[model samples]
Target: MTLPIEPTAAQQAAARVRDAVHSATVGLIEREQLAELIVLAAVAQEHLLILGPPGTAKSAVVRRVASALGGRYFEYLLGRFTEPSELFGPVDLRRLREGVVETDVSGMLPEAEVAFLDEVFLGSTAILNTLLGVLNERRFRRGHTQIECPLRVCVGAANALPDDESLAAFADRFLLHLFVEPVPDHQLEALLEGGWQSERAPLAHRTELSDIDELSRRVPLVDLTHARGLLADAIRKLRGAGLSLSDRRIVKVQRLIAAATVLAGRDTATDADLWPLFYVMPTREAQASAQDVLRDSMSAAANPTLRAAVEHAVLQPVSRAARLVEAARSCLQAGADAPGTATIAEALLREIDANFDAKSLPPELAAERARLIERVATPT
Candidate 1:
């Protein structure tokens, strides 16, 4: 038998990112997509905008992911009356005394490597205008205060997409748009149980900003030769379905594809990385349509690190099996050794049976199903 090969540094780093992602997601319910998206956008060096009603765990997920990565994080809620000073910083009165104007950006959005802004569309024109510079060029400029922003990824959240035509251009700057709904009826029991428990602790994993930078640096080095043709075909299919992306978006999707390659610990990209293109669809309706339109093209899509994302994007059985395996493991470990475990275990068993035919279920999920079934049948 051949000896096992050692993992490359890039692959090791990718694994760290994966662990950080799942660690953040451990106790959260139905928010796996957001946790995974945070890493995807961060690795791509792109921004993400999430549309969901309040009481969904959007802020909690972003905060935990940022903490896992160990960086300067800034979070703010923007409103019509919100001032640029609130996010950027107050101007320097000391500089004004010397007949100069500048903003003290210490501990503000510009210096933050990871940021989350709620109600992002309600910002005043000044805030948006100033923010455009940070998101686009990573540069902040004001009267006399100008510095390069260290932002790796920024997430914006709102109850819904903006209806104002004028705000559309600003919104379009964000490359990834995800619309999230509250936990489903079946998962409500788990959601309630998770929230009611006290003494929740944050993830202990330590992933530095440098690891993220390394992954992003690899994006430019990834060979996209084999994947380009399939990506082109996917674009054509999206247009054929009457769901269109801007020429700019068409070009920048390469960043996401390349980033996915880096996250997958590969130096070359392929059809397996193409699932990212689906998340770029501007609207939920367009995304639903393109899911069918580009299904055949991206049937090979898979990512070990982002199993939940791949499953959510492509809806493939293989990815679904991987995601379910993860959920099963979490349920077994995080659940208290108290009563009512069998109820939760039974729900998980039903989900596994619903998704896969008994004969076709992958061995990993099959084993998980067995364990869950045992847990359900055993008396507490």
Candidate 2:
């Protein structure tokens, strides 16, 4: 008989934190990508940027994840007229009288473990420099003094990418740049039903700071040699396609890939771990090309059968939609007078919708699914 293996301490901790954080933000519709990035960035001790318009639950997602991690949270919305004192804290008047210059550094970004800056690129030049140092070096420095920061990850949200070349450096500080959009039409009802629930109830289970600290320490220890060759090839392809990835960013990304491996309870990083690279493009225009390169890379590295299965599901959605419709109709007919018939039909509709998003199906399939749902929903 084969023996069963137990999970390592690091694996257990990673799973615990992942579950806690995911459960805390479950109310946000179609936010699986955002949640995964949040956990990955936190475990890697790197920053993230969410690019989307206002009211996309960008701030809510970060705030909820931070709350579940039981960390000191700081959030600010920057505007053209914003001042450094608003984000960094005010200077100490008493200290100035004694011939010293110091910001209080209390209850501000400098002291926060998880910080969210909405409209992050709107800060003035002075605040921009200070913010960059805090993000890149994890240290806050002022005239003649510097202090270490406890920031695990800083989440920034912006309506659009910065147009000025001067802000490129600041933009590069966040290793992961995820694009979030409003929920699709099909998910709107779920969004309305559950979105407010997350705001009202706090997460029951909390992940202590020590758990994240331990995970960070173990992330770099995971082996990356297995995927090194594939990663190099992907990097070449990205650069050949007009994307610029700095050496520092490349090194940082290794840590993120290793962190993802650890989260999967593996000691060796695999080609699949490179999926996060899709979001690291330096420019918005480069995202589609980068995605294509990364997807092709992943497909090349994946098993042939698995790749074909994914392609079939995504490319041949008509067959799958027909199957789902048939299933729903059968259930409704069998349980015509049963109380659970409507519930079953609703569940099938949700599955169809989820699969639609997963496969990026055509509008025709979506229309068919809607018609099927309506037929099943109408009383006999």
Candidate 3:
């Protein structure tokens, strides 16, 4: 009998970090995507931006993830009138007496290893300008003094994307732009039933700062050559689809892909590693287009079985429509003049048409969507 092989130290460490992040995210409804991206962003040592409406649990998710990592956490809510001192700490009185302009930089964002800033787009020019260095270079500079920041990752939450051109550069600082939406109707019951139990429970598994540092060190060692050609093709497709990626973002995103590969216990990046690119688009429309481009590219690169699986998943929305169509047919047969029957059928048809427009569905699925819409609209 062959002896069982034990996981290497790196694998064990990565597993521990993954488990800790996962544990923190437990009991969150419709937040798996955001939680996963948060963990990956931390592993990449990059910043993230969460875009969604109020009460979407954006702040809660960031807090739990930061807590799981066992780091000094700082959180702030920014408004249009927010001042730099509010987030970076006030200036020292001793320095003021000497006529030196320097922030205290104690127990503030600059000193924290993990930070969450809500309504991040509302920051004024002064506040945002001061933050650029800390977010990008992990260095805080005030006056003539510059201090290294211990920030591992900074997560920003906003209800909407910045409309001002001035905030564009600041927005681009966050590599991952994840959208958080309310839980689906099916999950609402579970969400209400669970209430605050999940939020109040203490995290059982914890990842120290050292574990993350080790993972960051390992990311660069992962071979990116395997995915380089695929990445290049996908980038070209994205640009052709009218979503331009800056040179700076292009270079930085490579590190994130490699980080994901390392976390998965692989030495080489794969097509699935490009999953994060789906969220990197600047706008919601561009994000949808990028998803189509990525899905097609990943499907082409995958083996026959994997391609079939991807195709199946991509067609799931249409499948749900088909089920709806069947249900409508039954309702019509059972009660031709039933109240709300026609209304429900029309609603389903509209949803099917909307799905077809939103996604780059395959030819077969597109044809099916059209047929379903026609059938639902026509009597009998």
Relative to the true structure, candidate 3 reaches a TM of: 0.78
* lDDT, candidate 3, 1-380, per-residue tens: 99999976667767787667656755564564566676677778899898889998888877887888788999999988888899998988899899987789889999999899999988888889888989989999988568999998889989888778888778998998877678766455446543355756678688787877877888888888978887888899988877898988887888877877767666788886665566567677777677676666655222110122122223334334443344345334434354334444454455455655645554554554455466556674
lDDT of 1 by residue, 54-167 (tens): 989899889888988889999999998998999999989998999999999999999999999999999999999999999999999999888999999999999988889878
Candidates 1 and 2: which is better by TM-score?
Answer: 1
TM-score of each: 0.95, 0.80, 0.78
Model 1's number of clashes is 0
Those runs of model 2 whose alpha carbons end farther than 4 Å from true positions after fitting are: 1-3, 300-348, 351-380
User: How does model 1 score by TM-score?
Assistant: 0.95
lDDT of 2 by residue, 134-174 (tens): 98889999875589999989999898888788886788889
Model 1, runs deviating above 4 Å? 330-344, 357-360
Q: Which model is ahead, 2 or 3, in terms of TM-score?
A: 2
Give each model's whole-structure lDDT: 0.87, 0.73, 0.71
- Candidate 3, position 128, lDDT: 91
Q: Using TM-score as the measure, which candidate wins? A: 1
